[model samples]
Target: MKDTAKHQGLRNQLVKLLAEKGIYDTNVLNAMNAVPRHLFLESGFQDFAYQDTAFPIGAGQTISQPYTVAFQSQLLQVKADDKVLEIGTGSGYQTAVLCKMGAKVFTIERQNELYRKTSVLLPKLGYRPRVVSFGDGYKGLPNDAPFDSIIVTAGAPFVPQPLLAQLKIGGRLVIPVGDEKQVMTLLIRTSETHFEQHEFGDFKFVPMLEDKNR
Candidate 1:
């Protein structure tokens, strides 16, 4: 009961922070609150779980800040039962949020260590993404094509063509594109041959590297 109360307190604090920052989407807020962020971090890092900064999660990857996760998830405009694809599954925090939002997620992680750890943790968190592979996130899951929404956590120089090909018509793809310094971008697939792009704002992220499977 004490752990539950602690998690609830953290959730309330996060909701308050997000609201003050103008993240007014109720769905996003609910999803963020539902997932226990502290469980996704190292036990010692529990105190910082409610804070709005990224933290190390081994293999040079960091669990993205809470606001950033909410921002990207909101930009995707995910809907209930929507088939979603997540490019990076670091810590599985974002994946858990997406799952709690009622999306059927297929997440891929390139790092073997992160993938292994998250695979075990996700089931314990009560939300298991359909597929968590130690493969190239850049290539995406070809077998699971035509996703309603796709989210890329790492920064890429340009939107990968393969991911574009995997989106269903009218689907949205939210990603960060650039080198060390990046900008969050949203791409809407208007038709079989047309896509509309929107730039969100300047941000920084780890560079998206091609996994060995590529």
Candidate 2:
């Protein structure tokens, strides 16, 4: 659970890899570096934490690859203090990065076990998202609608309507949509009734699940 000297060195190398692969947002890069990815993994896999691959975090979820996290984060265009609605809270690693970048995050996880584990673990690690709920991410947090940005950590077969409805005009939503392989998609709420969509190629992710529990 410690952010050891070795972990920081690995993260520094990871920052370089992310940079070579085009994740140029300084905030995103710094946040990626600052968070110790090893602490998010099982002890056995801790050494591989910064190697640019997803590692299982139980409950059928994995801590996302650092590049995917950084890539999506950069696309989010997060501003300090932006109210970010995160649709998945797997391992709380991504949430930690957002928090480090000064986003007030409201994150949801469908599985209660992962929810409880991360809810406890995050605060212990110093991440305090605005809210962390165990529920259907597709529905989002309507009471906290008008978010400045939203990021979905899993692959969705289709874009959920409620999530889109929750964004403030001019807000951004970053999601991956597809079945076998997802196309990283971004939506900008350009008007009260209109949105701008863009796709950024394919990536694999665990399918976004629904329901309050398994």
Candidate 3:
């Protein structure tokens, strides 16, 4: 679907709603406004794209709720040129937001269908991340270790150690940790072996698959 004036208007309203809900980060707000969320979903779901809710995007995964996306993006506090590692590419909506925030994003997706579709869709919309690999998100990207920040778009029963090991000192890792319900958790690597932890209430997300087969 083409991003028309009406779509932009809806996005603006969404941004306002996000701001009202305490997403104070202006960078995150602007990035959310810039990305055409409707284009990321199937045409039939375009009508619900701007709403702050999650909708299925096939393969049993749903594009995350807009507030969740904005909340995670705000938690990262990404700066221009910061190397950010994203744990689940999903529909590439979060990846696009990171790109818009001037981050050099390297993302991995466990679902092959989403991996292939997002790989093509993102660049076509001019939101090109550094790498969009079809692999396990739990393992993180060791070859590109020491990222400035990392964000996990799926819910995990526990925090993956490899992801923590891959962060640079002072880097942030935003993830939702739980089984049925998730508590939004953040880990900031302060030293080589130490990390500061914080939690921000609960959210629901598709379980993060372990292997690339999905």
How does each model score on lDDT? 0.90, 0.93, 0.94
Global lDDT for candidate 3? 0.94
RMSD of each: 1.6, 0.8, 0.8
Model 1 quality (TM-score): 0.96
Output the better candidate (1/2) by lDDT.
2
Ranking by TM-score: 3, 2, 1
- Between candidates 1 and 3, the lDDT winner: 3
- Predicted candidate 3 versus true structure: per-residue lDDT over 1-214, tens digit per residue: 4899999999999999999999999999999999999999987899989999998898999999999999999999999999999998989999999999999999999999999999999999999899999899999999998899999999999999999999999999999999899999999998998999999999999998686466
Could you tell me which residue pairs clash in candidate 3?
A: none
TM-score of every candidate relative to the true structure: 0.96, 0.98, 0.98
Q: Which ten-residue region of model 1 has the weakest summed lDDT? A: 1-10
**Against the correct fold, how does model 3 do in TM-score?**
0.98
- Tens-place lDDT digits, model 1, residues 85-187: 9999999999999998989999999888899999999997788788887789989999999899999999899999999999999999999999878899999
Model 2 — TM-score against the truth? 0.98
Alpha-carbon runs more than 4 Å astray in model 3: none
